[model samples]
Target: MPPAPASRHRTGRRTHGLLAAAEGLATAAALTAALPADAHDGGGHGHRPGRYQDVQLLSFNDLHGNLESPSGSSGRITELQPDGTTRTVDAGGAEYLATHLRQARAGHPYSVTAAGGDMVGASPLLSGLFHDEPTIEALGKLKLDVTTVGNHEFDEGARELARLQNGGCHPTDGCYTGKRFKGAGFPYLAANVQDEKTGKPILKPYWVWKKKDVRIGFIGVTLEGTPDIVSADGVKGVAFKDEVETINKYAKVLQRQGVRSIVALIHEGGFPASGAYNYDCDSPGAGAGISGPIVDIAKNVTPAVDALVTGHTHAAYVCTVPDPAGRPRMVTSAASFGRLYTDTTLTYDRRTGDIARTAVRSANHVVTRDVPKAADMTDLISRWNALAAPIGNRPIGYISADIDNTGDESPMGDLIADAQLAHGKELDPRTSLALMNPGGVRSGLTYRAKGAEGDGVVTYAEGFTVQPFANTVNLQDFTGAQLVQVLKEQVSGANAAAPKILQPSAGLTYTLDLTRSGADRVVTDSVRLDGHPVDPAATYRVATNSFLAGGGDGFPTLAQGTNDLVGEDDLAALGTYLTAHSSATSPLAPPAADRITVVQ
Candidate 1:
C-alpha cells in the first residue's frame, strides 16, 4: 500500500531554551524549598483545608494490544485474600479495562490516565492483524493522557512508530475502517531515545498536565539497554541514553519551567517479592520487598522527580524507594496484559506547586470481569473482530490438551522448538536441533474452544497469538563448542541478572543446576544430542528464529553461526507441524516439558 496523504505532525511540545538563567536559578531555589520532606518519616504537617488537591493518577502498562480477553494464564491475576491465601482472578480485555478506568475516575474531577509503555506489539489477532490500529483507537477512547515508549514500540522500527503517533492509514494494509487513522490522541514520550546524528529526542521528552495550577510534569523513558533486546533494524539511527541521566536532565528542564511536581514514567521495572497484585511491597519498609534495575534507577534519579510509574518486568508492586536525599518516594508498576492497574493519589500542594511526598499513596487493582463491559469498547471490539474473523477463525490444527507457556521449560516452548526444527529440515536436511527464546513464545494453546471452534481444534488466530512476532525460522551451522557457549550465554553475560532460557528440540537435552551460578549453571558434561555426547570439535546445524540469529535476548553466540538460510515464518512452520502431526480424531498432546534435567 502507498503512504497516506495526511502529513505527519511536528514533534511534541517544546519549550524555549533561552529563558533567563537568573529566573531559572531562582525557580530552582524555590523548588528546593517547596519539595516534600522525608516521606518515610511522615514529617509533613497535617493537611490544611483547601490547601492541597488530591490528584488521581491511574496507570497501567504492557497492554500488548489485547482488545479481547486474553486466554490461559495471561488473563489471570493473583489476589491475596483475607484468608491469608492467594487466588487467581480472571481479568483483562479492553471492554473491562475501559469500564474499570471510567469507574475509577468517577467523583475525581482532576484525574489523569497514563501508561508505562508497550501499549501494543505481540498482540492477539484482533489487534495485530490490522497493525494494532484497533488498540491505538481503543486507547484514545480509554482517555489515556500520556505514555512512554517501550522496546516493543520499535518492533516494526521508528518510522512505523511515528506513523502510529501521527495519523495515517498503514502504507501497505491501508485503512481498515474506510477512514484515515487519526493516530494516538495522547503523546508518546521518549526522553532517553534520541536521534543519533542530531542528538535530539525522537518524541516528546516530557509532557505536562495542568488543570488550573495543579500541574504535573511527566518524563518517559524505556530501559537504557533497549538496543540489546530489540532487533537492530527496529532501533536503527537511535541511541538509548542512561535512564537516570535522561530523567534527571529533563527534571531540570521541567523545574526551569516552574513545574515542580514531576513523575518519571519508565518502561523498566523491578520484581516484587510477592506475585499477588495486592501485595504490599512497602510493608517491610521502603523498597524492601522489591529488587531489580528499577531500584537502582529510582535511588539514583534526582530528588526533583516526585514519583516513578514503571513497567516491562510486568510484576505488580506499590513500593517506595528513597530519593538522592534519602527521602522516600513512590515507585509503582501494574502487571501486564491489562490485567491490573495502579491507582495513585498524589497530594498536590497548590501553594508550593509540588506533591507532598509524605501524603503519596498507591495500590494496584485488578481489571475484574465482574463489571459490565463498556458499550463503546464492545462496539469497537466487535467492529475489529468482524474484520479479523475471515483470517482468524480458520482452523489451523488440533490439540489433545492445554500446552502452556510457563516455567523454565514450557510445553508450548518445546512445541515451538520442534516445529522450527521440522521447518529447518526442509531448508537444510543437516539441521540437527532447534532453540527458541522464551520471550518469543507469547501464549499457549488450549484444547477448549474459545469461540465456535470445537474442542481440540486450534484456529489461525490462536496460533497467531502464540507466535506473533513474524520471525523466520532460520538455519545456521555451528561448532559443538560454540553451541555449548550459546547455552552458557543464557545464564551469563548480559542475561546474568535475569536468565533467558532457550527451549530446545526433542533430540537435545542438558542439566540446569540452580545451585550453581552464571555459566556454571549449565551442566556441560550432561549436554547431549540424540543420546550422543556433543563433541567440541564436531559441527552441527542449528535452527532458531531470526531474532535469535541477530543475537536478541542476550544470546550473542547464536549470532555468530555461519551458513544462514532463512525458512518460513515461525507461525507458519507451527501450523504446518500441527497439520502434519495431528487431526480431529488423533489430536496432539502437550509435551511433558521434561527435556531439561533441572537440579536445585
Candidate 2:
C-alpha cells in the first residue's frame, strides 16, 4: 500500500481550525445526547440512525516526545532461531512515521488519531526542555483526537499536564494554549483517574463523538499504578481507580445513551514474546503474552467495549484475546518513541446499533527512515527544531570514547550507574554500588575531539537525551539473598517460574552462563561484591533509580528492600552529579564485563 499523506494535508499556522472543527463537531453531539436528562435511555427520542459507515482508529503509544528521530541501539529484539542465531530490526522516530499513519487512515469515512500514553515526558531535549511542547504540536499536526494519561505524563504533575493540555500557568509563549505547543486537536481523558474529594475523574473520563450516523465513544485511562510510578509531587491529590470497574461503569452509561461502539485508549501493556521485542497479529504462535494489571483488565472489561488500545510497555504488537462475552477483543500497542504505528479497524453495525465481530483488524507497522518524509510533517518537525535549536543545538559536554552498546557491559551503562551511585551516596551514607538498568539508557555517548561535531560530543542536551525518563534516585537496603534474587531476574522470562532477572549494574561483576538454565544463568557461584564472594545471607545497601527500586523491569526485589528513600528524580540527580564532578576532562571507561560468558 502507498504510504499515508503527511500532516501537510493542512497548511499554515492556523491549523487549529481543523482541530477545533473536529472537537466542536464531536462535543456538539455529546452535549446534545447528554442534555435533556430525561431523554429516552437507549430509546433516546427514536434512535437517530447511525452516522458513520465504518470508523478507523489509528493509535500510537509511548511517544516519549521524540518529535525528531533518536539515536542509540535498543535491546536486541532477536527472533531466537532453531539454529540458535537471531534476526534483528531497528525501529524509531516521527518524521518517517507520519507517512505510515497517513496510509493507515486511508479509505475510512471517520478516522481518529489517538495515543495510549507516554506521548511525552522522558523526552529528548528537542522536545523535553520546552516540557514536551513540541511533541504536543507534532501530535497536533497529526490530528490526535484523545490520549490516555500515562505514568510519564505526570512527570511534571497534574497542574503541569493541565498546562500542556489547555495553556501554561506562566507568561511564557507556549505555556497555555495547546495550539501553541502542537497538542492533539482534542482533550485528554482520565476515566480511571479521579480527584480525591469530588470522586469524579479529574479529567473528562470519556468523549463521545458523532461521525456520519455513528455515535462512537473514546475512553482514555492511565495505569492504576500511575501515582506510585510518577514523581511523588506530580500526583499529589489524584487517585487512579480500578481499570475494569471504571470502564464498566462508563460503558454502561454509554450503552444506555445508545452509544454501542467503544474503544479504550489505555497506557498499560504486556510482556515480550519469545525473545523478540516487536510483534504482529498475523505472526504465528501466541506472539507476546501480556502480564500485569492490564491483562486482567483486558480479559474482564465490560464486553460492551469493542476494542482496547494500550501502551507503556513500549513493545509493539497486534493481538486479540476473548473478552467477558467470549467475543474476540482486539488489543494493540505501538512501540515507544514513535517507532511504530498501530492501526485498528472498528466496524459498527448501523442496523443493530452494535459493533461487528471479527470486523476488528489491527496491526503494528514499523516506521523506517528509508521512507520519504511527508513534506508537511518534515516541515512541522523542522519548525519545532528551529524554535528549540539554540538550547538543544548548543554544546554542553563532550565524550572522549565511544560507548558502544555491543554487550551488557558498556562504558555508557557504567557511567549511568556511577552517576546514580554518586547521587544516592549523597542522600544516604549506606549507598554503595549503583545498579542501573539497561532499559533506562535511551542514547549513547559519542566519541569526539574538542572540535568534532558529529564525532559524538556528549553535551548537557546529550546527557538528558540519554536519561530522559526522570525516574528518581532511590536508596534501599536488601539482604544479600534478596539482592541475588534481583540479579537472577535478568535471565527470567516473563513466563518464567520466578521473576525475570534482567541485567543489574556494577558493584562487582561475574560471568553469566546462558547455558545454565533459568535462574542458573546467573553464575551466582562466580558473583561478587567488591571482589569478594557475595554472602547470600548478608545485607547490602544498593543504590538504584526510583523506577527499578519501585519494581520496574520486573525486579520485585527492589520493592522489598528496607530503607525506601523517595523524591530523587533520576535525571535531575544525574545532571547535578555530572556537573559537580566531571568536566570534559573526565575519562569515560566502559563498565568492565565479567558477566554473560558465551561458550562455544
Candidate 3:
C-alpha cells in the first residue's frame, strides 16, 4: 500500500533561514515593548467581568514517532501510588495520546500544546518508513502549537530536517504517498543552532503564540553538545551554541517585544532518582534526586524566562528550580516516547502580559491505554502500516523470550555485539571479539506484542527499530594495553560523571569494580580474552561498530585502532546471524550478559 499523501485540513508555515526570521522575531520584540498586550480591566478580553485567566500549557517530549503502542519497558511508565507503592503502567501510543490531549482541552479556552523536541527520529517502522510524514500529520491533528529542535531532528542532517520543516517528497524516496508532504504544523524552534558559514540560526529562534491579545513567547534550544552525540556527518557544517546564553538571549528579545510570559523549550534534561513520574523532588533530599547538565543549565538561565519544558535525559519530573535571580521557576520533563504529557496551568496576568509565576502548577500525566483509541491516529497508523506491510512484516528471526536492554548491561546489547563479532570474524578471520555502545541499541526484542504474527517472531520492522543507525561492523587491531585503556575511558575523561559502559561479546570479559575511582575501576589483570589474561604487549583484532571506531560516546581509545576493516551494515549482520542461528523450533534465547563482572 503506497501511502496516500496526507489530506490537509490546515496549511502550516515555517521560518526558514536565520537572517530574515531573526529580523521578524526582533520586530515582534519591539512591538511587545511598545504595547501592553493582553491588557484586561479586571475583566475578560470581552466586556464580561473575570479574574486572571488560566492558560493551559500541555507539553510532552521525545516522541520518537511511536504511532503504535511500544512493547516491553519502552511502552510503560512508573507511577507512584498514594500508598507509597509504585506500579508499572503501560502507557504511550499516539492513538491514546490524541484522545488524552483532546479530552484534556475539553473546558480550556486559552490552551496551548507544545513539545520539548525529539518529535521524530529513532522511530518505529510505521512512521520511519515514510520519513515520519505520518507523525507530522498526527501532530497537526493533535493541535501541537510549537516545539523545540532535538538532536534526532538532525539525524538525517540539516538538509533533511529542513525538508521535514518545509515541504517536499524525500529526495530519494520521491513520494511514498500520492499526496505531497506538507511539513510540521508547529515550528521546530532552534535558537542555538547556527549555520557554520553565516553564523545565524538555521531555523526560527523563537515563536510567539497570541490569542485575544494574550501573548506567550517561547524560545527553543537543543543540547549544547549535540555534535558530540550525533553522527559526525550529520553535524559537519552546523554549530551548536551555549544553551543558557542562547536561551537567555532570546528570552530578553521576547521581553523587549512586550511578551512578559516566556517559556524555554529545551531538548536537554536532568535525571530523577525515582522512576515514578509523581516522585516529589520537593522532598528534603530532592537535590540528590535530580542531577545532570540540565541542573546547571536551569540554575544559570535568565530569571525572565517563566518555565522550562525539557527532554533528552528521558526522565519525568515536575519541580521548581530557582533561576539566577533566585525566583522559583518550574522545570519539567515528560520522559520519552508518547508515554507522558505534562499538564501545566499558568495564570496569565492581563495587565503585564506575563505569566503569574507564583500561580504555576504542573504535573506529568500518563497516556493510559484505557482511554479510547483516537480514531484519527488509528487511521493514520493503519494507513502507514498498510504502506509498510510488505517490507516491514517479513519475519526476521525467532526469540524464546524477550532480550532487553534495561540496566547497566543488557541482553540485547550483548546480542548485537555477538552479531557484530560474527560479521567481523567473517571479514577478518582473526577478529577476537566485539563491543557495542549502549545508546546504539534503540529498543528491546520482545517475545510477545499486541500486534504480532506470532509469540516469538521478530519482524523486519522490529529488527530495524533495534539497529536504525545503519552503522557498519568494523574490525581493527589494538594492543592489549590500549584495549585496557578503552575500558577505562568508559568511566573516565568525558564520561567520568556519567559512565557509558560498552557492551562486550562472549569470549571477552572484564571486572568493573565500582568500589574504586576513575580509571582504577577497570582492573587490568581481570581483562581477559578467551579465558586467557590479555598480554599488555600483544596485539589483537577487535570488532565494533563504526561509531566506536570514530570515538563516539566517549570511548576515545577505540579511535586509535590500526588496520581498519569495514564489514556489513550492523543491522543486516544481526538479521543474518539471527536467521542462521535460530528457527521456530530452536528459537534464540536471551544472552546471559555476563561479559562484565561488576563488583559493587
Candidate 4:
C-alpha cells in the first residue's frame, strides 16, 4: 500500500498522534458480546459491531545506534530456504528503516511502533561520538513510540540512561550541537530494573499508549541477567529482578487499571532452529527449535499479558509459545541492527478490553534500501555527519585486507587481543597476556576503506565499529591455575553448548580438543606461555576488558582475579596501537588465530 498522505503523517521528530490506541472502555463488556445485539447476521464489507479492531504493533530491536547503513557482514541477514539452506540479504540503516516503517503504517490507522531495546549503546563513531544523541534524535524522527531498556542502555550507567530519557547535554561533553538535547519523546520502560536502595524501578516501569478510547499497557524490562553483561559501573546501584515475576506483577497492575490488552517489551530472546525470520517454531516437527529463557518466561508469565516482544539474542523469529493458561500467544524478535522490523497484528476487542489471541499474527520484514530513503532521516544523518566528520574521518591505521571475526577462532579477535595485551603491558609491565571476547568484535575491518581515505586506510569510524563497547582494559592478579580454569570456562558450564572462545594475545597458546567433553576440551598439557608450560601454582597478571573482569559472559573464573588495575578504554587502546604501530608502507596484517590449536 502507498504511504498515507504526507500531511496526514508527522515527521518522526514530532509526536506520533496517529499510532495511539483508544483508551478506557467504561462499559466493561466481554469480547464475545462486543457485537451489537440488533446487528444483522448478513455478510458485508463494512466493519461489523462485533468485529475485532486490528492494532498494528510494529517492533524492532538491538539497533545499537546504527544511524547509517551498516557495512560488511553485520549488514546482512540470513534467510531460510525451503531446501533447508540459507541466503544472505543486505538490509538495515535508519533512513531506509524509516521509509519501510512509514510505508508499512500507510494503510493502517491504528498502529503503534515499539522496540524491544538495545536501541543505543555499543554504537558506531557517528552516533557514539555524540553520546548517541544523533541516534535518539533519529529514532525520534523514526517515531519510535515506546521502547524498553536493554543491557547496552546501561553501558554508561543508570545516570547516563536517565540523561538520555530526561533530556540534557552530557554532563562532561555538554551539548554537541546548537540544538538542545530534548531527550526522548518516547518513554523508556524499565519494569525489572529496580533501585537497590529505593526498591523501585530506576525508570518508569510501564507505559500506556492511549488514543481516545483504547489503551494498551506496555511493560518494559531488560534481561534479568543484565548485571552479568554490562560493566559494573553501569549497574552499580541497581537490581535486576526475575523477568516472569516482574511481567506478571505489572500485568496485574495494568489489569486493575482497566488496561486488559498488554505487551511485554522484554530485552531478552532465543535462537531459532532455522535462520529464516519465517521459520515455524511451533511446527510439530520443529522440536524445540526456538529455545532460551523466553520459552520459560512465556510459559510461566500470567496469561493477562497478551504478547512478549524480545531482543538481545539478536536472531529473528515470530513464534507462538503457549502461555500459563496453555493458550497460544505471540512471541517475537527482530534481528539486530535495524535489519528487520516485525509487524504484529493485535486484534483488540473493545467490549472485553482484551486481545483475541487466536487472531494474532506476526512477521519480520527486511528493511531493504532499494526504495527512496526517508527525507527526514536522510537530513538527520547529513546534519550529524557534518558535526562528526572531523573526528570520525581521521585515519587511524592501515590494514592489508579484511580482518574478520569468523568461526572457531578469528583473526580480528586475535589482533584485538594483541592490541589489548600491548596496551596492558605498557600500563603494567607484569601483565602477561590479554583475551578478547568474540562478541565484542562487532564488525570486520575492511581493507577497502569505507570513506574517501586511501584503499587500505582505517578511519576512526571504522575502528569504532569494530570495537564499539567502551570497555576498559583491566589488569588483575590471577594464579596460573585460575587462568587455566578461565580457559576451561569458555567451553564448560553455561557456555558448553555455545562456546564463547576467548581470543588470546601472542605468547599464549592452548589446544582445544572438541572430542573431549566440557572443561576437558582445554588440553592442560598444551597450555603454554612463550613456549613454556604455564605453571599452575605460579602467580600471573592477566588482562581483559572490565566486562570479563567482573565475570560477564559466563566466564566466572575471570571474576576470581584480585588486585584490579584498570587501564585505558579498549577503543582508545585499539586506536593508539593502530596509529603507533601501523603505516601505509607496512600495514597490519590479519592474525592467523593459530594460538588456539583446535582438534576435533
What's each prediction's TM-score? 0.92, 0.75, 0.92, 0.89
CA lDDT scores, all candidates in order:
0.84, 0.64, 0.80, 0.80
lDDT for model 2, please.
Answer: 0.64
Q: Give the TM-score of candidate 3.
A: 0.92
Off by over 4 Å in 4: 1-50, 285-287, 428-430, 494-498, 514-516, 562-565
Q: How many clashes in each candidate? A: 1, 31, 7, 7
In candidate 3, what are the lDDT values of residues 54-99, reduced to their tens digit?
A: 7899999989888789889989888776687877878899998898
Which candidate model has the greater TM-score, 2 or 4? 4
| Per-residue lDDT of candidate 4, residues 163-239 (tens digit) | 99999888888788766799999999999999999999999999999854568999999888777666677788999
* lDDT digits (tens) for residues 1-600 of candidate 2: 101100001000100011111111101000011222232223235765332245678888888787766555542223333354556544556766777677666655578888888787767777776677778777877778888888777777777777778754333333433434333467888899888888888778899878656677878888776654454567778889988888898999888888988888888776545324333332443222544445677889989998888887665556666688866677777657786676666666766677664556665555666566778878866776666556555554444566654455556666677777777778887776778766566666656432234554556567667776656677888887887777787656431332222334556566766556777777777778777887888878888776677665556677788867774666667666556654556744445544335431
Q: Candidate 4: give the clashing pairs.
A: 12-141, 13-141, 21-211, 22-213, 22-214, 23-213, 23-214
Best by lDDT: 1
**C-alpha RMSD of candidate 2:** 10.0
Q: Rank the candidates by lDDT, best first.
A: 1, 3, 4, 2
Clashing pairs in 1: 1-172
Model 3 misplacement above 4 A? 1-51, 285-288
